[model samples]
Target: MTQTTPTTPVPPGALDGTGESSKGEATDNRARSRAAGPGRLLAIVLTGQLMAVLDVFIVNVAAPTLRADLHASGSGLQLVVAGYTISYAVLLITGARLGALIGHRQAFLAGLTVFTAASLACGLAPGTGALIAFRFIQGAGAAVMLPQVLSLIQRTFTGASRAQALGAYSAVLASGAAAGQVLGGVLVQADLFGTGWRPVFLVNVPIGLVLLILGPRWLGGAEERPESRAGGGAAGRSGALDLAGLLLLAAAVLLFTVPMVLGQEWGWPLWGWVMLGLSAVLAAVFAVYEARLAGRGGAPLISPRVAGAPGMPLAIARIVLAMAANAGFLFVMTLHVQGALGYGALRAGWTFAPTAVAFGLVGLNWRRIPARWQPVTVPSGFLLAAVSFAGVGLALRDGSDGGPWLFAALVGVGTGLSFAYSPVLTRTLATIRPQDAADASGVLVTSAQLGMLTGVAVFGAIFLGHGPGVDASADALWATCLALAGAALCGAIVGLVIRVGHLR
Candidate 1:
């Protein structure tokens, strides 16, 4: 062989396929050292998560108080709940894309700051109109903060640490709603030095402040991947946010949500149906627009490819139906027990304690589960929940006995917890590349939020449409519980399909 000019040798592994990834991991380790330790980072993120979840559930408890204190109309109260959820859901994709452009840590701080300030405004709001407006803004803040949680966890940790962190996150997700119900009752009952329901919002003030001040120091810059930067990837510097797509998506969601929120109060007016029809058209338009954009190699608010992946559509559908029914179950049960059974707020709160406990016990230990077995957990869990819910319906039908009802609720919650901690998220987004994880997280969360909105609107409409009475309330509870069982059945089917498909 002819002698070649001497050249510097590349270090071993330097030019290997994994070299870049190894370098990235090293960089992340260095950055983590400069920032907060894993424990502190976990605390900061989990606290943010708890606040968001608490706000969603706590408001249900505060509905009656809102109506009484602010002289809110039925539709207005619905708006107070729906407004926050709608805004939160609508803006999530934009929020995730934003975190990529700026930095997740920065976005998280900005969101927390805004959320804290808005909570203060909500506490001080003098009228129903003002409260609704503030709640929307608060929700917008939540949209920004929530996506950062998953993104940061992925970026900051690895291996066993990642597993542990995710387990805690899931536990909080499982328990947050039930915990909120109980906490909301205690605060409302205490009245917090005559603040009435205001303290529910006010309590976030101190907690949020501490997070805001230290968050920047504790959380460092996001670990951005080079390929991810070009699209909806981690810390991607996408040319620009697809504002047109965002607007279209927002319009579609608003169309669907507004009718659901206002239809009952307006006596199921013709216009509401028209809006629902329009929502379908707009949703179709959004889908088409996203496809065309993706075809052109452009960034869409939600990546069309990811949304259309194998299991994603099914996952979204399952989440919407199951979560909607779950939300409706909480609402109708609260109304029936407090309204018809004459149970105090505290008593009503205690009704869900077993669910909360079960969720905590199972969810915190979710990581101990082996990967191979995790796939079957979701369907099994849902089946158990379905049986428990049917039992609740049977109890309600048989004179609403306290012992049977509470026992069913306990078993339902525990069963719900057992399987709800499954890796549905990872399975659903299995086709999604690591670069697009944040975008997938955003889409997943948005679907869940919309599901909650659907639950409140459709179920609330049913409850209000029947007018007020012990009998009407009982009917509403029975209807809602049956619906929950049905929803769980649907979930079980979807889960089984996914699992069977995997076996192939």
Candidate 2:
């Protein structure tokens, strides 16, 4: 009865819960090897991100062609652009959460598949309504995919490697955004595959296909941390989902953004104000709910705890303000180029090329820029941009038709440096805890989207209220420049705050 075979007991900490460290020295070695090796997966992810960002500006250059072919009204055209943006912005928080719940790699692949299919639908849509619908879907896919790219890099790499990856990500963003207008112009003008403006959407299909094929082989499996698997069983999956929070967030964004996009077109009707009021109420309610969830030790959609972090909210505010000013500048400049200068779409697109080139070049050197210099860069960018805007106003006032090239070049330099701010915000955020990273990213993106929405609305109203006039060109340009200068001043103030805070 006492003949029990002696068994060797496993030592404490032998199994490091999630099995992340259980692979021992060999696993660490492998991770280091992968980190040092050329990352095919990273490249694929960046390409997808580049495509998503590019789509934001690509259609701007093709708007006229789309209007003619689809017989879309001015509102319809705005919807084509706004639809994607609003959808993407709304889903960003939810997407990040979902990616965390299911593996990031799986989420990325799933999003790519959806986006690729939606692109096909967009290209094939017979009318404006259909196109707008598909664009919304495409944007939703983009929301899901974009977050995973950042998360995967964060998970896969460490230290200097992480910084390098982020820098590369930044470079892709700058280059893709700049290239969009040029590529769209070329594609639209060429009438590729006899598809009119359809090729712009269709071009994504091949790119998506390549990503789908290579993703499985290159992305590797999800590396679950010990804490992630602590609860075990269905609890692990349930912890990931956060369904109620996601629904509330989605509702909050829709209620807010819909009015902003549609209110001007509808003459700011009673319904629109009602929606806005509802949105504010819903936002408040959502905030309370998230707080309660956090208190209960449950994961909220955005995680209220992170919002309370020092510098996070301030960073978000700065991002929103800067983006608003930038968007307004673009809106006014577009009109100035096309209406006042009488330049065609292709020529107007080309005018912004120098900015793109400069941005790409500067973005590559972002890694070397110190964190302390980040605040400085923002103000400097705004100052340069303000000067460029002033130059435009001066030229318009002087009735000089031919010197836009020089003014645009100055704007280009400003825009190039403008590329640094977001990355700077990202870098500042790297100090945050891992669990809060997704929320930070979401906040950063949401602020930028809101800024864009506000910018378009405010600047569009200013431009339209003044009415179209050749003689009024100088007045319009001056008014826009003053507004931009005001924005720059705000950015400067924020930079000062950052500097002072650091001093403390």
The candidate that achieves the highest lDDT relative to the unseen native structure:
1
Give per-residue CA lDDT, model 2, range 330-432, as digits (tens): 6666667778777766777676676666666565565466755543565566566666666656666654563755657445544634543545554544544
Model 1 lDDT tens row, 1-504: 111111323233321112232344545554674576777888998899889888888877777877898888888898887777767777887777777767677788888888899999999999989999999999999989988787676566554455566667766765777788888888888887788889889989999999988777677545444235434452353556778888888888788877766676678789889988998999999889888887886777776656765567666766676567666667667777788777777777877777777776776665456755555666666777777776776676544545856676665756573455434543343344435656777887778777877776777666655557776666666666667777777777765565555568
Weakest ten-residue segment in model 2 by summed lDDT: 1-10
Off by over 4 Å in 1: 1-34, 221-237, 308-310, 370-372, 399-401, 429-432, 461-468, 495-504
lDDT of each: 0.70, 0.67
TM-score of each: 0.86, 0.84
lDDT of 2: 0.67
Supply the global lDDT for candidate 1. 0.70
CA shift of 472, model 2, Å: 3.2
Ten residues in sequence with the least summed lDDT for candidate 1: 1-10
